[model samples]
Each structure stands twice: as structure tokens, then as C-alpha cells.
Target: GAGVSQTPSNKVTEKGKYVELRCDPISGHTALYWYRQSLGQGPEFLIYFQGTGAADDSGLPNDRFFAVRPEGSVSTLKIQRTERGDSAVYLCASSSLGLAGGSQETQYFGPGTRLLVL
Candidate 1:
């Protein structure tokens, strides 16, 4: 009955440090997504996972970013060598099914984890 939820509502770290953001999606949802939102802009897709493997990872900006959904229910976004430019709100969303043939599915978003690189 619970909805999507993210941990550490906020995070502060220095550049070059590593951080792991966690996301717990709604139970039974088959599709999960990770996104990043910068100032004055909407959330940008980073990755999508259907089950245990990453279905789409094209949105990943660089090799420093990676995500995994090991068991298909919980996911973790790992950032290696954090940068000042990466300071933004990291969001997680889940849906019953990912976009199928141009049809849309309602995605429930968690209160993003606001990361600040200081």
C-alpha cells in the first residue's frame, strides 16, 4: 500500500566524493526510473529498469553515474566522483508498466533527494 519513497531527503557532500541514493518503489510495480532535476528545469531521465536489469540507460550523462535494481523492488543510484555540476534533486519514479507503444502510464514520484556538492 505504500508509495514510492527515497532516503536521506537531503544530502551534502564535497566534490569528488561518492554517494549512493536509495529508492524504494511501490510494491509490484514492474518499471522503475531515475531522474535528475536541475534548477529551473524539469526532471531529466537518467535510467530505467524493468525487473532486475537496466532496460534503458541512455540518459546517463557520463560513466560516473550508474544504477542497479538487483531484486526488482529497490534500486540504488551510485555516483562516482561527484561534481558541483551534479548538485540537483535526484528523483525516483515507478509505474505499473513503462511506456508501451506510445501509451502512457501514471508514474508516482518520491520526494527527491536533494544533493548539494559543497
Candidate 2:
């Protein structure tokens, strides 16, 4: 169906508040990923999901950041006690389970959700 879609393209909130970012990935794609990027910095991996379970979550900064994909389709990133440094563009991407070295099973990126914590 769709490539990938994120809701609330922009978010503005005060520090210490909570925020939830949503991501809808392409149908039939079993792999999903989340990333965060600040000014002048490259996207840093936050989490990766294979199917409905999180295959890896080492990139999360602390206990404040969390994500879930219960149904294996839509995913959400939750942040509690948000900080000014937490402000960044949250990106989502999807790719097929396996990619050949010479093939282009590259991950498809979605328009990020820019979160600004004032």
C-alpha cells in the first residue's frame, strides 16, 4: 500500500511533557526502524522491529524513550519527561526481511516527525 507515513509532521511541547509519535509502514514489509536526528547530525538508530516484536532497542538514550509495534503494522514512539535535548526529527523506515548484496532492497524512508521541546 503506502510507502511510509508519520502523523503530526511537527510537534511543539514544553519540557517535562509527554509525546507519542506514530509511524505507518508499507504493507507486507516486516521490518521497521526508528531513528532520531538533531541539527547537523546524522540519524541515529533508536529501535528496530522485525514483525511485531522489537529485535533491537539498544539505541534508546534512557528510560524516557520507548516504542511499540503490537500489531506489526503501526508503530509508536513514546517519550516521557521530555527534555530539550530530546528535540529532534524522528524518522521511520521499512525494508524487506532479506536484501541481496547486489540488490536494492534498501529501506524506504518516511517524512520525519519534527519534535521541538521548548
Q: How high is the CA lDDT of each candidate model?
A: 0.94, 0.92
TM-score of candidate 2 on Cα atoms, chains taken together: 0.93
lDDT of 2: 0.92
lDDT of 1 by residue, 2-31 (tens): 989999899999999999999999999888
Task: Estimate the overall C-alpha local distance difference test score of candidate 1.
Answer: 0.94
22-68 per-residue lDDT for model 2 (tens digits): 99999888889999999999999999998899999999999999999
Q: Which residue ranges in model 2 land beyond 4 Å of their true spot?
A: 99-104
lDDT of 2 at 12: 99
TM-score of each: 0.95, 0.93
